[model samples]
Every structure is written in structure tokens, then in C-alpha cells.
Target chain A: MIGLRALATGDALPQVKPEVMRMYNMRFCPFAQRTRMVLLYKEIPHEVVNVNLRRKPKWLFERNPFGLVPVLEYNNEIVYESSICDDYLDELYVERPLYPKDPHRKAHCRVVMAKYDKMVPSFYKLIKPDENLRLQAKETISEEMKSLEIELGDGAFFGGPQPNMIDFHVYPWFERLTALKSIVEFDILQENNLHRLQLWQKRIEKLTCVKETMQPKEWHLEFFIGLANKNPQYDIGLPQSKV
Target chain B: MIGLRALATGDALPQVKPEVMRMYNMRFCPFAQRTRMVLLYKEIPHEVVNVNLRRKPKWLFERNPFGLVPVLEYNNEIVYESSICDDYLDELYVERPLYPKDPHRKAHCRVVMAKYDKMVPSFYKLIKPDENLRLQAKETISEEMKSLEIELGDGAFFGGPQPNMIDFHVYPWFERLTALKSIVEFDILQENNLHRLQLWQKRIEKLTCVKETMQPKEWHLEFFIGLANKNPQYDIGLPQSKV
Candidate 1:
């Protein structure tokens, strides 16, 4: 099911039992990856329905009028927005408890998450065709990375002994930084004084959930390259027969 | 405390007992208003320290590096971002729960909040100096108001008969629409087919929390006009003696 071609505008919605939870996802989307990571980390039994974002199916709009992915359908109810999805899952499951128990600590994680949200546009800018824009984005991202390094001070992860929701919330974009660098000839992590962040990335990458949910850098490269060329191959890694 | 002049750069930070929670705020900022509304709704005893966004106090950055308002300081721990502050307050003080008790219902509220967040840029555009941009923003906001009208179908409030956290989250922006309309000859709530939303605005405005937290429409008008003219009077409503 994971390897199936993305469902496009005219494609039929797949049948899933009402008991099972499903996620409307796009394989290359960082926002969707955050939800996918949480699902895996929490060991929630679910199905993935990859959508063609450029030519989204009509049913997708029914689930979320905004037509964005990381939309979770559970027990016939819909929830969208990556952070909201992750928070909902965490609250419902309550097994591992991704957020800190203390209200102040949880708020701190959220504050950092808010900062990361603001920095995302710069990450997207790195993939833009304009060299000057990409350079400016790199500068902004580098400055943000320094802030992240400070936030990560003396801890293996943002969650401190373990990877927390904030860690997963940010990891997808960090995971994509490599693909972005390959496309833009800039290495934000390596070239900047971000040693702590580099180590944090390595630590997060070693997690099982990260391993399971991640698409390879090469796949990201191919997808972004297609996006830059104005013809995104949403079914990039699917088998030829599946496509 | 609410009527104090906004403290600008180099101004001394006021002394508040560590036991008393404080919010770094701008009186006219709608984002700050959300936090202020939540605090009042929850009846969390807090002091407000208004800031001059035009020349923010140096110490404001110590609380929130972004130097934006609605930064909550409780027990010496800082939390910024308006939604984060509201959520932190809701979690810390559970009584009179603004959010629905059911997880799915809470998630639904969040979904609506996300839609509201996306529509805000267009609302801001209504105050822009350019007539064409204002016209375009009016069209976009009118379309979004219709969607809100549908969302409010059959319910007196988004929270269904009572305002919820999502109601407070979106109310500050809606409250400013009238002020926006006064500046630009466009009336999103009045001109569009949004009777439900128009009524929702009235219901929200009548709430005690909203009344206590909100500035008058005239204050919003004067503040916005100053903003449009590049000379924001953050301390407009304050007494001349205080200024």
C-alpha cells in the first residue's frame, strides 16, 4: 500500500475499513512526514493514502477544504494540520507521551516549534531557482540553526533523554536539508557553526521511527528536481507496474 | 495596569511579584488580544505589560526573542506565540475548560482555527495602502466569510451555543474587521452573505471576557490609521500623564 501510485484527481478512493485510521499523505511533504513519524513512534495501526497534491482528488477536499495533507481520518472524523494531527494522536494514544508532562516544558517545546514554523519558508526558498534568494535563505536558515543549537544545549534531543514530539516535528525539514543542499550547492549544516545540531540530526536519524518514516535523500533529490522543473513525479519510487 | 503607556526601547522593565503572571502585550495587536481574552476567560490572575512594537524595549527580547507580544511569563518561565500561550494557560488551569472535553471535538476546533490562521493575511491586506490590494483582499475575505457562515450553520457559536478556545482564537481578528472596514470602505461581514458570521461576531463581542479584553473600535481605528501612516500610536488610549 505504501508503494502504490499517488491517487490523483480522477483516481478512485481506496476502500479502507471504518475501524482503521487513515492518513491522507503526500510522500515528499515534510508536514505529512511529521504525522507519519508520530504514527510510527507511537506504533499506531493505520493506513496511508498518498495524494497527488498538484491534482488532488475531490474526496481529499471533502476531508480538508484546504486540500493539504497530513489529514487524519479516524473513526469517520477528520483532523488536519500536521501539529494538530500529532497532538491529537499523542493525546489519544497516551502510551509514550511525546510532549513533556510539565505545562511550562510543553509550552517551551511549542515555542520552539513556533520558531521552527517561521523558519520553514526559508527552507522552501532554498529550493527556489533564484541563486540570490537561495543564498538569503541559507543565511536565514543558518542563523536559525544556531538558535536551534542553543536550544539543544547539553541535551541529546530537544526532549532531553529521548526524542519528543518537537524533535519529530522538526526532523522532516532537517532530513530534507541534504536534498536541498545537493540541489543548491549550499551546506547549511556543515558550513555553518552548527556542530551540536549536526550531532542532534545524527542522533535523531538513528531512531527506528525516523528510519521507518524517512524517504531516502536521493528520492527527495529526484522529487525536488522534478518540482523545480515544474513536473513533480509524485510516484517517483513506486514500481513501474504500480505507476 | 492595562492603561499604562507602552514601554519602548531602553525603558526599565517593571517589577511584578514573581507570583503574579505577566503577559508581554501590545494593546492593539489582535494576536495579543487572543492571549488576553483567554486569560480573562479562564480568570487567570495576570498583569499586562504593554510594549511598543515600533521600538520594543530591550528586555522584551529577553522574554521572547521575536519581541512579539502575548508572551506569558509564569513562575519565571516564558512562553510566547499567542496560541501557545492560550494552550499553556488552558493546560495549566483546567477549570472552565475553553476547549471541548472530547478529543475529536477539540481537534475539530483546531481545524477551524487553522483555517482562520490562513485567512488572516488577507484580513491584514485590507489595511494596506494600495486600493487594488485592498479590493483583492476584500474579495478573498468575503469568500472566507461565506465559508465561516457555513461552518457556523445551525450553531450559535463555533463551540456550539458557547464560545470555545477556537472562538477566542479567531475573535480578535473578527473584532478588528469593523475597524478595518472603517479605514477602507469595504465591509466583509456586512457586504457579503455572512449573516451567521455577522451574528457570531456579535455573540462573541457580548461575552464578558471579550468586552474586558477588547479595545473599542475607535481605538482600533486610530491605531490602524497610525500604522497605515507609518507612525503607530501604541499608547493612544493611555492618559496623557502616563505618556
Candidate 2:
């Protein structure tokens, strides 16, 4: 029986000395990336099988009755849900912690993560070149950034100088700010005056482990287009994008 | 310091004493009602604050940063996020276990819950009454329910004869099936030979404590209609005329 545990988003998990611990996920899926971030951060050595989410590999459906990504299989046990996977990582490898020890801070970080997962991505999906929607996306995106900036105000990142679990959980979605700006002509990235967020992004990007697990840029754009096109089962960023 | 612990969803949570743990939630909000069901099954003494979806209480925002209901304030500690609140409840109280004893089973429950939370609700929201969308919702709802029925095949509920963490997590949304039959006329609850699900609903509803915590029927219907209208946060399940 695997013991219960907790780990946050992007902490490199230490590679367990080779026992069949594998992660079933897709490269472009943000939820998968949550677990991937933990794996790379923990330096946990495991097999990575990318599932064709649209076609959904048979084994994945077999392993996961729910048929979602970021399904982590450790030994004979499988833990799914990106947040739960983060929890498993925390329990599996205790050396380096990503989630905070403080309860209030932890709750707040998760709330922000949940907000990003539930609401922010809609700006990326529902925004169109329509004159009104474009402005709406920009304003919404900027507002979110401003609020998040206030939350991260004096800190270098979400959790002080170092990127904590909340930072790891949200950074990928925040990257979509650039995507939103590029596609929607909404310069929310610059308008929010998200000084710390910008620096934090650069800092996180420089992390070798995160870079190792980062998805291809085009894959994301392609996936988003599919989701926007009304493709069923191709949900990448729809509300439940994160764990 | 709160010690790290785990428990099943429907299990009795740790108690500071009688009536101190009050939860503000409703039966319609998939997230909110999930914890409500757990509290009832766990036999915890809790005051249910029924917030009007349209006119949410001012105190809810103070307890919740996002102003969403389903906030759990106990012993001067506040935890938000419906699932997290449920988990926190289980964490604090372990007499009745909501989380599974096995890590693997727990993982399965989490994914199933995540799928309902993310996939089911997101799909439900995007659906409009247009011919194309209605048809699409039909197919989508079918696939969703069929998948869930298979998950629940031969089980009394999601986890077994007695309701478990996953059941409380997933049931509330599917319970929408009941309202959906009246409003849009879907077949999961009506057809599909899902004898188990209907029975499951009765069993869940029959719980003395569970039935007591539910919100007013008129409010529920209005809320679903509002969700369909996108006027309020969720669909309150009233007739479309009210909408």
C-alpha cells in the first residue's frame, strides 16, 4: 500500500532507485505538466508515456477508468489527478518540499491555483478577434495579473524568492498571457505591470528541470485551437485544466 | 499545529465540539453539495447555511477570497475550495474515513472526482439549447454517464455499498441528471437501464442527515436555470420560464 503524501507543482522529485514508477500524460496538457513538473523537480526517474488525448491510447483508458492525463503509476499503484500526483510526489520523496508548511499560505496558494485552473484559461479559449471580446480578454487578463501581482507583491515569486508549489502550478497558465497577447492583441502581459511575475517567469524558465519537461510551443497552440473548435475529449484548458 | 492526516469523505471529521463546524453551501453547486453530503454521512453536527446563489451572503466573500460559497470555518481556520474543504474535513476528523485506506483506490477516487469536476461541469456549461449544442450535449452527456456507470457497475455507489469519498465527489453532478430529465430530457437517468444510479440516488437521499441539509427546491430550480442563462454562477435547476 502506497502511503499518503503531499507535494506541490514544480519541485524536482528525486528519482527513486528504479522501481516501475511511470507517469501517463501528454506533453501539451497543463495538468500533465503539473505532475511532470514535480517529477523533474524531484528528479524522480520514471517512464513517461505520452497519450494521444484525442485518440486516447488504449492502455491509458485501461489504466485510468476516468481517461484523463497525468496518471502516475508507481509500482503496482496508480495515482491520478495532477494535485494528487503532486501529493504522491511529496510522500514518495521528502527531501525537497514544494508545498508550504504554513496552512494559510498553503490554502491561499491552492486557491490561486484553482482560480487559474478554473477561470483564467477561459480568457485564452473564449477570446476572439471580435472587437469587444478582444478588449474583454485583455481587461480580464490584466485584472487577473494585477490581482496575482498584489498577492505576489513584494515577493520575487509566489512563495518569496523561490517558486513554490503554487508558482509551479500557475506559471504555465500565466505563460498563456503571452499567447493571449499575441493572438488577441491584448497587451495584458505589459499592461499589468507584473514586474515580479515577469522576473519569476524568466527564473522558472531557466530551471533545467522545468525546461526538460516543458511542452513544445506549437503543440499547445494546436491543442488550444482544437479545444476552441468544439472538439470533444480534446479539452486542454477548459476550466479543469489543472488538478 | 494541525498534524498531517487523511480520512475518507463520508467519515466523521475531527470535532472541536457540537455545532461549532458550520458549512455554508447548497445542494445544487456540485462543489458545495459534495461536502454537504460528506458531512451528513459522517454524522458530524454542522449548521448548514443555505446561501441564495443569486444573492450570496456578504460573509461568504469574507470567508472566501473568490466569494464562492462552500467555505468551512472551524476553530478559527478557514479552508476554501470544495474538494479541499472536504479533504480538510477528512483530515481533521478521521473517525469515519472518506479517503480510501489504499493509496491506489484513493487515487482512482481523485481522478473520478476530477473528471466530474472538470470534464462533466465544463461540458455542461458550454452546452446551450441550440439544436447543434443540444444534440452535442445529448451525445456528451451520454458518453459521460455511460463512462460513469461503468465505473459504478455492480457497486452500491461509487466506492461500494456504502457511499465513499468518490461518490460524494461525483454524485452531485450526475444528480443533475434528475433535474436534467425534467428540463432538457436526457436519457441517462431515464433510460440507459441505469437501475443502479437511480437506486443510488434514493439511498443517498434517504440519509436522514443528508436530506436535512439540502436547499429549497425552488431555489435549486432557479439556480439551474440561472446557470443555463449564465446570469448566476451555477444553474439553479428551476424551470426555464423562471430564467
Candidate 3:
């Protein structure tokens, strides 16, 4: 399991090892995880420098003006934003080629990713303890899932016959489904209606890259539930007692 | 001048010419205009089908699930979203490659575009008749323009030497700057503070594609001001009195 460490104001910046990629990440950040999944899938030679997002180091801000991650440091240049980082990685290391070769299909993949990207706010709403908001979020998720089912269309993955950018981009959200489920207790992926999505979830988990990178459901639930309850130490990456 | 014709229910769908590309656009939509500039830049032989956003034709929805322009129809298929459409065009027609060749530079171009895209809502705020919101929006635009001045960094365009995807993606918002200037009377591109941005603007206007496609300042002012005043005929693509 990945762990988080806080970097105070004067903390030493992580050394940039020659010829190795560095990823600045927060263990529980879905956005960071998105980039990490790509690196893991590509089996890129890299080092992970976990940052406690609450107390960001000046170096991180230097690397990324916005001070967000996952920032990829390679060849003496740093790039942030998960999608851009993923695009950079995919283009630089073309062993698997995440995007499709056909221009229209590539555009289609990007459009589908944009559609699901809009659902992130609704996903956050589900983690709220409020029942009304939970119901609303669930409804939004179901509608999005229905759209996903349609987008999946007879293909094993969004790109057909293999997982591509669309699948990699969206999987992080579903990785937290177990956490949301424990709290909201609504079955978003019912087999009767969402059998395709259900199967897709299982298939994704079987991948070694996903399995190795994913945090257990307990860690997600604990962190998110504490976050909802206004627990300040939620980001300490440990239980309240430990903090 | 390209004319504005609203395609409503029962209107004939534009013929899919055997070899030509078709663009579904609204004359005034900044997003739609992004695609037009690209088509004009490439001088790609294409047709324009203007959709009535107010009462969208069924055919528009049939082609695009969101019924949004600009939709590119070619080879018996359709794709929407300005960025996606522009990407498709750039890839399919490589004569004038809108994107950079190097991977890092391409990512950098995309990141710059994403940064400017966030400024649109603030741009709309300036169009509001309310003074408080207008001032707030002005501050946001100033900050963004300052950042733009930094990003321009001795380059004629966001991409060195010539305009690329970043320049085209961001120009639409600035296209309306003249209209906003007439209404809000705030000079964003001050000669002293924003000289680089101001110069960049003039450089863009000199491009034949931009010159051919841009609506005059007077037209943009009338439409956006009417829009701010809650005029019901805003979407009719006609002046208020005509409605």
C-alpha cells in the first residue's frame, strides 16, 4: 500500500535521479492515481514522491505553478495535469499506444473521457453523509453508468478488444465504488441493468497493474468518511488514533 | 460574410456532398467559431450547416447526442466538441499541422489552452450588466491576461514563429474582447502592462482566416449586450426588433 508523507516549508526537495521519471502524488487522490496507473501499465522506470497535499512543498509549486499533482518530471522538464501527463507518457513511450491510430476513433475516445470527467463532482457528492445529496449523487451516477453501458456497446472495453485511454481515464472513479457503496449503500452496478459495467469492473481488477496500484476499500472508506466528518487528520494517511 | 441561417424542425438536412466536409455551427457561438477558424486556416473544402440552438433540429441531435456545434460530418460519420473536431481536422489534413511535432511541446500547447479555457466564465461575467460582477470578472480577466503575457514569452504565437492549436483554441474568447470593451469599457490589453498580449492580438487579426471569419465589433456588441439584457430573441440569430 502507498503511504503519504508531509513536506514542511524547508523540507529537502526529492532528488531527480538521472534517467528516472518522478511522479509527485497523493495516495488517495484519484487524479494522481490516474497518472500512476498509466505509468504502472507502461512499466515505466520511475520513482514516486508522495506529498501530503495539505502541506505542499515549495518545490512542488515550482515544478507545477498550480502546485497540483501528479506532476511528471522527466528529461529536466516537469508536466502536471493527469490527462496531459498521460498524453505525454503515451506519446513518449509507445509500447502499448493508449490512443487509437484512427483519427476519428481517437477523437471519440477523448469525447467519451470528457463525458465521464463531468461526473467527478457528482461522485464527490456521494461521499457526503447527507442522505438527500447521497440520493441525488446516486441518481447522477446511475445515469452516467447507463451512458457508459451504451458507450461500451458490444466491446469488451471502450476502445474495443482492448482497454485504451478511455478505460484508463475512467477506472480510478470506479476503483472507489466500494468506498462509496459502504457509505451510500446503493448498488450502482446492478447485474440486471449494468451487467456490462459489472463485468468490466471485474476485468479491470484482474489486470496486475490495477491490482497492484489500487488501495484497499477499507483505506478509502476510512479516509473519505473521516473527510466527510471534518476530521483534520484524515489526510495523515492513518487512523485517527494513530495520528 | 458567412450568413446565419437557423435550421429548425422540418428543415432539410444539409446534403452530405460526396467528398466534402460539413460543419454544423451557429454564426455567433465562440465554440463553433473555433472550428470555423481551423477549417478556414486549412482551407479545407467543407459545408456549414447552422443549427438553431433554441429549437434544435432532430437531425442535429441524431448526429450529435448533445445537439451541440460545431459537429464535423465526414465519411458518413459525425464528431462534436470544438477541441476534438479541431484535433480530427489537424490529424486528417496535415498540410498545416495545428499541433506541435515534439511530444513535450504538444503537451505544453494543450496545457496553455486548458488554462485559457477556464477564463471563459469570467469573460461572461464581464458581459453581465451588473457592475459588481463586471468588476469581479475584470479582475479575473486581468490576472489571466497577465499570465498570458508571461506565457507568450517572446513568441509571436503560443507556438513559436506561427499560430498553432493553442493560439486557435484561445482566440475565440479574445475575438469578443472588442465587444466586451464597447460594453464594459475595460481595457484588458493595455499598451504598457499587456503589450505582448496586445501585439499577439494584432498578429492574430492579420491572419487571413481570422480576418475572413470574425464578425465586426458592432455585431458582437449588439448580440452579447442583448443577451445580457435577457432579450428573448437572442437565439433567433436576428436582432431583437426583427423577432
lDDT of 1 by residue, A132-234 (tens): 9988988888888888889899899988898888899888988898766665776787887688888998899998889987888899999988888888889
Ranking by DockQ: 1, 3, 2
Comparing 1 and 3 by lDDT, which wins?
A: 1
lDDT of 3: 0.80
Q: Each model's TM-score?
A: 0.94, 0.70, 0.90
User: Candidate 1 DockQ score?
Assistant: 0.86
The TM-score, computed over Cα atoms with residue i paired to residue i, of candidate 1 is: 0.94
Tell me the DockQ of each model, to 2 decimals: 0.86, 0.25, 0.65
- Give Cα distance to truth, residue A27, candidate 3, Å: 1.1
Error (Å) of candidate 1 at residue B217 is 2.4
Q: Taking the tens digit of each residue's C-alpha lDDT, what string does model 3 give over A1-243?
A: 222454545678866775778888877888988898889888887888777555678888888777788898887877788998999999989998899898878888887887688788999988766889877888888888898999988888876887788888989888898666766766788732898988888988888778877888888887786667765232444465533
A160: Cα error in model 2, Å: 4.6
- Order the candidates by lDDT, highest first — what do you get? 1, 3, 2
Most accurate candidate by TM-score: 1
Runs with alpha carbons beyond 4 Å of true place in candidate 1: B129-131
Indicate whether candidate 2 or candidate 3 has the larger DockQ: 3
